[model samples]
Target chain A: MNFPSKLIEDAVNEISRLPGIGKKTALRLALHLLKQKESVSESLSQAILKMRTEVKYCAVCHNISDAEICGICASNKRDRSIICVVEEIPDVLAIENTAQYNGLYHVLGGVISPMHGVGPDELKIASLMKRIEEADAGVKEVILALPATMEGDTTSFYVTRLLSARGVKVSTIARGIPIGGELEYTDEVTLGRSILTRVNYSAE
Target chain B: MNFPSKLIEDAVNEISRLPGIGKKTALRLALHLLKQKESVSESLSQAILKMRTEVKYCAVCHNISDAEICGICASNKRDRSIICVVEEIPDVLAIENTAQYNGLYHVLGGVISPMHGVGPDELKIASLMKRIEEADAGVKEVILALPATMEGDTTSFYVTRLLSARGVKVSTIARGIPIGGELEYTDEVTLGRSILTRVNYSAE
Candidate 1:
């Protein structure tokens, strides 16, 4: 589309570079910004630039943080013995929102995907092994909370194999029909897994 | 959702304020930006801020431009005797893309919408009238090329009533079934309009 101004064209081009945003949507967003107060645009630009320039990653867990070590890893309240392994910072946030897990996290940054040229060495897997080997840390069990995709499975398998030799218990999150899912609508693979992994019910 | 860092939280909050973007989508976009090169984020921020600060509007038609007079309004190739009135700058681009209409434009900025607290005074209606009255411009006709919505119709009606007293020819774009639209699937109002406004077939 022909833009009346080079500035608008530049803004639209930059905005359309974002994932899921097309040229039309970018134009709409640029016009909306034009109609809004100057402070709105200023704040948005400042926030984005500041976040990009000053963002930090936790040295221990590899999760995004403002300090050397993340809050979860540094906190005494969280259980250091059980570490939940995740693919990214957002996964850590998703698990934290449940408020069910009190253990620290080990963010692998991403799962093993050969298609994307991401290998085991590219992730934080080596650091995870080092953390587990530290006898003073007292890490006993590692929960594989990564996605259920093939890449996730490959990463989990590789991590578990390495941990088995080090005498650390490695477990994966249960895969089955969701809590509120209907059995008839559940896929065959998940339904079959749910039955095979069934456990005895107890009132206690 | 809980973010690991204050910077990420602030960026997410600001980004989510944009139209059609929710908290979850904003989080995803923010994380995507974090993973990209720093120059990408810097350029996006710089473009948006610069556009907002330095963007200019055309002096004659109020369309967005980099200079006082827009290219369309200042061009000698465009028809000066005919003006197509539109709701916004996008409409101008849409018509221009067709490569059919060569007339100049008068951008109303927006339609008359009392629901949104926008009225005739808020738009560029008065300036349009002044342009029509200017003897040197030689404007002989005005086309109402607004949307088919109620607000668009209301604004067109108001403008037509004001222009009728000045003895200038007034016309509106035809409302009918769109090209490639099926007769069975077309809406009743549009189909009826199409039939009512049908022209005599002449083998040219």
Candidate 2:
């Protein structure tokens, strides 16, 4: 579509470059921004630039942070003996939202994917191993909370194999039918695996 | 959700302030930006800031432009005698995409909505009247191509009533089932209107 103004076109083009946003959605968003107060756009621009330029990775976990060490890694409330390994910072947020696990996290940044030319060496795996190998770090168990994709499985296998040799207990999040999922709609592979891994249930 | 960094949190907050975007999507977009090259975020920031600060509106039609008058209004090829009135710039784009219309456009910026405290005075309706009153404008027809909602109808009624006194023909775009729309799935009102406004068919 021919834009009436070059400014609108430029904004739309930049916005559509984002993942999942199309040209039409970008146009809608650009118009929405135009309709808002000037301060909204100003703050949005400032926030994004500031985040991108000044953001740092945690020295220990490699998660995005403001300082060398992340809040979770610095906190005394979290268990230092258990480390939850994740693919990205969003995973850390998702797990933190549950309020179930009170452990430190090691963000791998991405999983090992040969198709994308991302190998174990390209990730923060070396840092994770260094953290685990520290004599005084007190880490005993590592939890792999990566996705259920093939790349996630490959990364998990590689990490667990290395950790097991060092006498560290390694585990992964359970995979099966979701808690509220109906059996009829569940995929065959997940349904079959869920049944095979079923635990003894005792009704109260 | 709790963010690992303050910068990420601020960016997410500002992004989520946009219409239709929630906290989760904002977080995802923020992380996506974080993973991209710094130039991507920088250009996006600069584009939004420049557009919001330097964008200009056409003096005659009130459409967004980089000059005093928009290209459509200034062009000699367009039909200056006919004006297609719309609610926003996007509507102008939608009509332009069809490449069927050859007339100029008048963007009202917004529709009349009493609940939202938007009145006729709040829009660019006065400038539209000013354009029609100009001796050299030679406007013979005014098409109300606003949405089919109650607010659109009210605005159209208000504009047509004023324009009728000035001896200008007032019309609206045809309302019926869309092209390629399945008859069985069409809504009752639209289907009924389609039947009522059905034209005579001739077979060659």
What would the per-residue lDDT of candidate 1 be over residues A63-85, giving only the tens digit for each residue?
88888887888899988899999
Q: Write the per-residue lDDT of candidate 2 for residues B62-110, one digit (tens) a residue.
A: 8899889998988999988999999988999999999999999999989
Query: Which lDDT value does model 1 have at B1?
Result: 79
Cα distance off (Å), candidate 1, residue B59: 1.4
- Which one is best on TM-score? 1
Residue-level lDDT of model 2, residues A1-204, one tens digit each, is: 999999999999999999889999999999998888899999999999999999999999988889989899889988999999999888999999999999899999899999999999999999888998883867889999999999999999999998998899998999998889899999999999888988777952
- Candidate number of the best DockQ: 1
Task: Report the number of clashing residue pairs per model.
Answer: 0, 0
Off by over 4 Å in 1: B135-137
TM-score, every prediction: 0.97, 0.93
Question: Candidate 2 — which pairs collide?
Answer: none
For candidate 1, please provide the TM-score of chain A on its own.
0.96
Which of the CAPRI classes, incorrect, acceptable, medium or high, describes model 1?
high
Report how far off residue B63 is in candidate 1 (Å): 0.6
Fill in the DockQ of model 2.
0.87
